[model samples]
Every structure is written in structure tokens, then in C-alpha cells.
Target: MSSKEVDVQQVLNTVGEPTRFRIIELLSSRPHAVGEVATALGALQPQITKHLQALEAAGVIRVHRLGRRRVARLDRETLARVAAYLGGLARADEDDAALDDYQRAIAREETRLAEGDSTRVLRFERDLPADARSVWEAWTNPARAAQWWAPRHFSVRVFDFEPRAGASIRIVLAEGDAEYESRGHVERVGAGRLVFSLAPVDPAGEPLFEARHDLVVTGEDRAHVRLDIEISAVREDAAPAVAGLRPGWEQLLDALDAFLRTTP
Candidate 1:
């Protein structure tokens, strides 16, 4: 009856098909066009299209027009919703059994990326059920930003934050006993968008790699905002760092959504 409640049987039935499950695995890293999906699955275009459409209709995959191409990407929030439901039911046996399958699915994408399929830039776009102003405040305000800037399992400490062009922005990301300091300067700052250059530093304060993060927020309607996050300037050798950027940011965005949902 609620947005978060999903038909468990429906999810099980939809993912039961081997082809659909494989399609979901293929999209774990990045979005794929219909042709790309066909090539990845070695199936005919029409067949893959039908599978994708089914997944899209089931809310597991989202199909959107990116420029002239229709691309399908995993709807992580929807997946997370279902995962939360399953976890709440205390399905430990099923969860334990799924660990291996999940790892294998992720390994397929990692293999592809390792074999010279490195991406120069990582991009993500999501529509949040929050206003642009709230989203902007959550990003620019130091305390709010600290709440969700790091990945789900990590925490962030904002040492120096000035959300203005040419101002300093420094943060320490802590995961357990390990910590990394990132230093950067804000390049451009506006009402709904912000751009900055960031780099991780060693103990000696030497830069690891130069990177840039650009975020744009668009007011979609009275109660929704579309946010675009892009990371670039990733060095070739540092490809591994950005490799997990997609899922890293996805979890952070989920954190942001949770923050907003509770705060509102």
C-alpha cells in the first residue's frame, strides 16, 4: 500500500528468469543502451529489448532518454527498498545464499573495467523527492553535507568548508581506523550548482591525483529535484580509485535522501 512496500512474489518472479537476471548484472556498473545490452547478452535486439522493458516496467531498471539514445540503468533506490523489506523479514538464509551470486555478478563488471574499459569520467543522475532549495542547503551547509557526503559505511569530518568560488574545502573521510584527507578549492558556486577541484593527499600532503566534482540541482516540480553528479580528471593509473565512484556516490545519494526524508 505504501511506496516502500513491494510485492515479494513479483520481485522473485521477475528476477527468476536467467536472462533478466543477467541483464540486471550487466547494468550494475553503468547504463546501457538497448543495442549495448543486446551485444552484452549476445541475444537478438528484440529479445533484449523485451527483457529490458519487462525489467523497466517492474521498476527494477529505469529506461530514460539520454540525448538521442534510450539507456537502461539499475534503479538502486527501488532495489534498496526491496532489500530493506527482505532484511526486515530476517531472511538470513536467503541473504547468505545470495552473497556468492551477488559477488559473481559484480565481478563480471569489474573484469570488464579492468580489461581496458576504464571510464574517464563517472556520471550519475537521480531525481530526489525533495525541493531544490533543500537539496542545495544539504550540499552546501557544512553540517548537513557532513551527514551524507561520505559513503554509507563511512563518515566525514569537514575541517574547513566555504561554499564559495575560490574558497577552501577540506574534509577527512574515515572508515573504521583508516582516514584519508581530501583538499580542494571551490571553483564555481551558484544557487543550484557547484563545481570544485579535489585531490587526496598522502601523509606528506602530496597530491595523489587531480580530480573535479561538479553537481547540479534542478527543481523538477514543487516537491522534487533532479540532481546530476559528475566526477572527472581521473588519472589513468588512478582508474581504480574512480572505478567504485559510481556505487560510492549512489550510496551517498541514498544517505542524502534518507537525511532529507527524516528531516522533512
Candidate 2:
């Protein structure tokens, strides 16, 4: 086998072990000395050092001398090259089956988890010269909504939208080839408040996940909107979804503020 092939196999074999996987996970966060990693893993320092040396040989990790201690960290560049190679292989018919199987196994594991309710609420108050009707029109209007929906790194496309009760809205966000859809029926529409349920839709327009949004115009010349977003599947997973949503909601509120400021 070629040297590159040998290195690839070596990396796969080393990381296939549970202990080595843990070591990589730790090193990915920050560089660690052999002794520190050993202590963290409750293993002998010698065993940790051996694994580190093997990882280094496989080009999966890099070691730097830190005075008396040697610090090790993940070699991200090397890993990126490995990932690119894997993606190329995945495009091949023979390798696609293995990738499909791995994905199916992950999906099965995710499905087995008990469902829970994970809801995040964000409220914002903003002043605008536009009346409630105008504001509502700006929000539900495709052209106006796209102008400020995602201020950074996202573009919105609305195919269908109506602001009245029992009407549905569909919006697609584009970032590269990655597309996300939000669709739902308008549940309530008051003098200044509009409540709706939004669920992500697949490419075929099937609901992927559901969330609720409540926009209340708490004061005239100003409006207060609160979005109550709940994802059943992600609620069960908890950690990642919770961590991601906290900042995400804050950013969305910021986007709304920008939108209100720009809208007449």
C-alpha cells in the first residue's frame, strides 16, 4: 500500500478505540500535556504517551514541547484533508453504502430517545413610525421580510404568505446549497398581536419540526414580539439544541430590531 493509504488506515485504527477517541475529543478542545490527559482519563501516563505518539505518527495530532511538558493538540488541517478524502470516497458507489449505513444507525439511535419539550422564548420591544397594519405587512410581505429577516449570512425566500388568521406562510433561507423552510398557519391576529405556529418543511414541503411564534404589539408606535420555539426531537437531545438556541434567539431579535428600524 502507498504511504498515504497506510497513514489513513493507521488513523482510522487508532481513533476506532474508545480511549483514543476520548483523547482526541479532549485535545480538540485544547492542547493538553500527556500527564494532564492521563489524569483526566484515569489512565497511566505511559499509556497516554504511547497513544499520543501513535496519533502523532498517523498525523492526526501534533505535539509541541512546553518546557518540561509536551503538549498535544488535534491537527485540524490534516483532519480536513482526511474529511475531504472521505467525502470523495462517499461519492463513489462502493463507499456510499457504508456511509448510508452509518447515517441510518445514527438516525435510529436519535429516534430511540424519549421526546421532551424544549421551548425558547425571546421578547423584543421596538418603536416604529409605521402602524400595526404596516408593520404586519412588512413582516408578512416577501420582499420586505427578506430585507431584514437574516442580517448576517442568510438570505430569505418566501413563496407563499398571508397575514390573516388561518393563513399559512412559507419561507426558505438560503446559505450555499443549504436550504431551511419555515411553514405554519396564522392562529391569531388582533389589533397589534399575531400568533403563529411555524414548522420546518423538507424539500418536498413536509413538516420537519414545529415551533410557535407570538408577536404582540404591546404599545402603539411600538411593538413587542415574543417567539416561543419548541422542537420535540431536539428537546430530547437537549444539550446541543439548548446551547445553540440561546444565542440564535438573541441574534434573531437583533435582526428584528434592524428590520423595524428599516421599515417605513
Candidate 3:
């Protein structure tokens, strides 16, 4: 029904009466004649018929003359619309609660940063359908890393990537007209884990902030592996750069998951 034609108050009032509500409940099970409804609900035939009329007028039920008898049935489409409206209300409440939680987290983080907490740590873990060797390759391969290193909406370019310890790493991220670049060194490397650090830099190669990152890969099975990534701020001034680290890593990991699903 059109929004303008929806009389919510009228619908509520029509169903507010106990007798009418009972009749609607009865009709909900199946179509029934007035006499049948009266018999099922132990209601007087005249009273049940009047209740059905009110419900029909409110568009809650449909009545038709079936041969010599009148039959009534709940309007499935209207009931579905009402159900969807109630579901939307429930979803709205959930969204509001989640938003409140996010705001509180942001406030707490801001307070911590303002208090000069030089070390901020963020971690992410995910299981992907790739073996340890393949996962390792994806992480260490510059081209494969570029395919999923950035967030869902951003693009990434690898300037130089060397996974060996003490090797240099540089990456460029682009979104629209904006570009973000970071350079770092692989601190340590092993078969299952790697440690590194990155400093956001300007176009002239000036360091903006510093972060230490640790990545661990564990084989879950012959065909799957679990990856853990942790990033920590190395300086008090790095707080601002690391503030958005959690979600940024999450988005990157999510993109990686998507890539693995489609890669092979």
C-alpha cells in the first residue's frame, strides 16, 4: 500500500479489541467462514462477524462471498508488510546500539592518546583457505600483496618489497586524488612469522610516524592457514597515525580473504 493510504492508527484500533484480535488469530491459520470462526473461538456468530468486518475495513483481512457463504482470510501481503516494518525497527535499535559502542571506543582511545600513551597496539586474525606456503607467498610477493594490501575501496602499489630481515619495504596507497606512502624494514623473518616496522612519509621521503608490525602464520591444515597481524605505535606522536589502524587492517584482511577466494 502507498504510505499516504496507510492508516496505522486505524489498523491498531481495529486489532485492539480482544474479540477482533482473536478473530484475526483464528483467520491467520486458514480461511474460515463466519460460522466456522465463531465455532472455533466459541464466540457468538454475530460478534465474530462484526469483528471480521472491522478487520476487513482496516485492511488486515480479506473477505469474499464464497458461493452462498462468506469466507475470511488474513491478508498475507499486509501482514508481511507489518512484519517487515517491525523487523526494520529492531534493526534500527541494533544499529543505534552499535553506533553507541563505537563512539565509546573512540572516546576511550582519544583519552588514552591524549594522556600520552606512546604505545598503541592493534591486532587482527583470520583463517583463509590457503596453505602456509601459499599464504606466505601471498604475504611476501609484492604483486600479490598489492592486490589485497589496502582497504576494499583503495588501491595499492608496491615500490619495493623484500621479505628478508633488514630488507627495505615501500608501498603507495591511493584513493581518488590522495596518496599515502610508507617505508619500513623487515625486522625479523622466519618460516611462520615476520616482524617489521613502517613510517608514513611525505612525497619528499620525510618520515611522518613510526609503527612496528608483527605477522604470524600458522598452518591450520593442509589446505588452510591462520594469519595474525599486530601493529604497535613506536612513539607518542604516532598515536594519530595508529588511531585508525584496527579498522584499516581489518579492511585489508577482508580484502585478502576475498582475493584468496577468487585467486585459485
Candidate 4:
């Protein structure tokens, strides 16, 4: 093979076995004859020989005739290649921001899941550089909400919304030619708080689950927001939606934060 490349996975599989790893570790000190290696590890000669043959096939080691006995030594170049391959994988993860987001969601995991095993509760908090009044408008006003209502990769069209007890709420989120509808009503809306229930419908026009949102905004010159979401009435086919709820809301909140900062 090329000097710059090696079958690292094959070498891993070969050395991954316990006995093979022990044999390689034994040889690392210096080349050893087959019988000497078996004697060092207290393993049978035939078993050690079989492991040595697999390692040889994977280019992890080389066996040579030393006078009358056969001796095996590690191939330094192949082992170096495996180290570089693993280093590259570690660097790739360092550049991924989504991994940080997932870590944040995991940190917020509840002490105990809902008793019924059919409901999930999620909580999130963000501090935004805007007053509570304007942040409230961003959520309730269609003209303002349209700017940052949907998550990434979706555009929202607000058809109806009334900020009062028992008023109707409806919005359509479109991703290219595909459209989704969310319908519900306000439980209460006042000052800097909104309590509402929303159900995002599926393709067959069935509600996925009932999500009750208790969003509260505080602080004067700058807003401190807290949101508690409880999801229930989960339908059988709502698996994907349930899994995505935390990430989806994370994106939406980020969008709102950006929109409010840049708005006139």
C-alpha cells in the first residue's frame, strides 16, 4: 500500500481481540518468537499463533525467520496510520456546533419523565436585548411574528391570531411546496406572559400532540424569558415530531433573538 495510507479498520479488528492485543503489547518491547510470546502470556502456542497470523494478514505485524525460530514484530508505520485516523475523527467533532446544542438539551433533561410515559416536558430560558413589551409583540402580532415565527428552513404565514382568553390561533408553516398547519387558542395573554395550547397537524390533517406553552417575559430594559412546554395527547404517528420538539424550539427562539436585535 501507499506510505501515506493504511487499512486502519482492518488493523483495529485484528488487534481488538484481547489475546491479540496482549501479544502485540508483549512484542512492543522487542521482537519475540511464537513460543516465547505464548509462554509470556501463559496462553497455548496454537492460540497465540492463530492471532499472530490474523495480525500478519492485516499488515499490523511482520514475521521473519531468526536463525531457526520465527519472530514477530509490530509494523510501526501501520500503527501510526491508525493513530492519525482517530485524531482526524476527534478534530471533526470539535468543529460541530450542533453537538453543543444537543448537549444543552441533554443537560435540561427532567428528573423524571411523565408518569403516563406518553408525555414530555421541556424548559428553556434565554436573555434577549429587548424590552418585555416588544418581545411580547413579536409573539402575538402577525405583522411582527411573521418575521421570526418558524424554525430554520420554514416560512410562516399567520392567518388568524387574537391575544385574549379563548381566542383562535392559526398559522401555516411552509417548507417549499410542503405546508403544515398549527391550530389552538389562548388560555391567557397579558402584560408579558402568554399561556397557549398548540397542535401541529400531520399530513392527514391529524393533530400530532397538544403542546401547552407557558412563556413569560421579565426585565425592563432587556428581557429575560422563561418557557415551559408540556406535550401530551401524543398520537401514534407523532414519533418524529416528539423527537424534534426541543431542537425545533431552540431554532425558533434563536430566530426570534436575531430578528429582535436587527429590527428598526
TM-score for all models, in order of appearance: 0.53, 0.47, 0.55, 0.57
Clashing pairs in 1: none
lDDT for 155 in candidate 4 is 89
Kindly report which residue stretches of model 1 are placed more than 4 angstroms away from their true locations once superposed. Answer: 1-119, 220-239
Pairs of residues clashing in candidate 3: none
TM-score of 3: 0.55
lDDT value, candidate 4, whole model: 0.82
Error of 2 at 107 (Å): 16
lDDT of each: 0.74, 0.67, 0.74, 0.82
Clashes by residue pair, model 4 = none
After aligning candidate 2 to the native by TM-score, how far in Å is the CA of 43 from where it should be?
Answer: 41
lDDT of 3 by residue, 1-264 (tens): 764565767887888899888887888778998899999989788888788888998889999997989999998777677767767767756446544755666666667767766554565677877777777778888778878889755787555888789999888888888888899899988877878887777668866556777788887553343334444443444444555566667677778778877896
TM-score of 4: 0.57
**lDDT by residue for model 2 (124-171), tens:** 455554556667766766677667675356677555767788997776
Which sequence of candidate numbers ranks them by TM-score, best first?
Answer: 4, 3, 1, 2
Query: Cα miss at 32, model 1 (Å)?
Result: 62
lDDT of 1 at 7: 63
Write the residue-wise lDDT of candidate 4 on 129-241 in tens digits. 79988888888887888888888778886557788899978889888998888888899988788999887887676788889999999998899999999988776556556
Of candidates 4 and 3, the better by TM-score: 4
Please say which candidate is ahead in lDDT: 3 or 4: 4
Clashes of 3: 0
